[model samples]
Target: MKHLPTSVKCVALLAAALLPLAASQAHAATIHTQGSIQYVCSGVGQGSLQKMQAQAAKFNLGFWMVKGPQGEYLANVPVKVMQNGKTVAKFTAGGPLCYLKAPAGTYTIEGRHDGQLRTIQAQSGTTAHYLRW
Candidate 1:
């Protein structure tokens, strides 16, 4: 039997280590919105939001939402996730909170509730943004 070279062995090890990460990413959250107000049932819900949040943390992206003044979860708010001044995702809040999985970078998150437009910035990592309306 022939032994592999050191460089080839290192490359093979790296690929092996990264394979599971790629596979998990492929199974990561998929966001879908409907009527500009709500995420499709298949994509939005408490459970789904949790999954998205996990993915956002794993990918070093933004994830968070808007809330009411009295600490109530505000629903039906329209939200837009923007990067580089271009709208990337748009959806309506099905509950008081929503989850976003954006690329690791600066993002402008805008949402409207109770006739007011609220905007905030979301950063990468495990930080969660809770905007009050």
Candidate 2:
């Protein structure tokens, strides 16, 4: 029926167009595993970051990717997690933040961008770490 007002119709169309974007933004992140390590890298946004933060306590390794002269946030960075001089996990981060569930031990996190590399060390007790490049 062509009875609904123009304003109502516009609103309905807008909602329909945006529903997919909203759903994609809020999609649940997947947890990945390598050897004995379980990890996840999730994009940043109020809702998504909050979801990751809620489970932060369960992870022994955490990383925040940062870059730019003014410390702008970063995403999709290539990272590698290592322990005892062995590769533990190797993957490109899906977003600017990552969490890893690992045994209590020291770890080396390496991130590379634009031919530059940044490395950081983390222990089971450390809350989080910023890896800048």
Model 2 lDDT tens row, 62-132: 88898877877787888989998899889999888899999899999999988789999899667569998
Global CA lDDT computed for model 2: 0.86
Q: Name the best candidate (by TM-score).
A: 2
| Position 10, candidate 1: lDDT | 89
Candidate 2 error regions (>4 Å): 1-26
Candidate 2's displacement at residue 11, Å, is 28
**Candidate 2 global TM-score:** 0.77
Model 1 scores a TM of 0.53
For all candidates, the clash counts are 3, 0
User: What shift in Å separates residue 104 of candidate 2 from its native position after superposition?
Assistant: 0.8
lDDT of each residue in 1-133, candidate 1, tens digit only:
1499988898999999999989856554555543321222123453655655454433444334445556655566787777779887777755554544445678777888777888888765545676576
Off by over 4 Å in 1: 1-30, 33-69
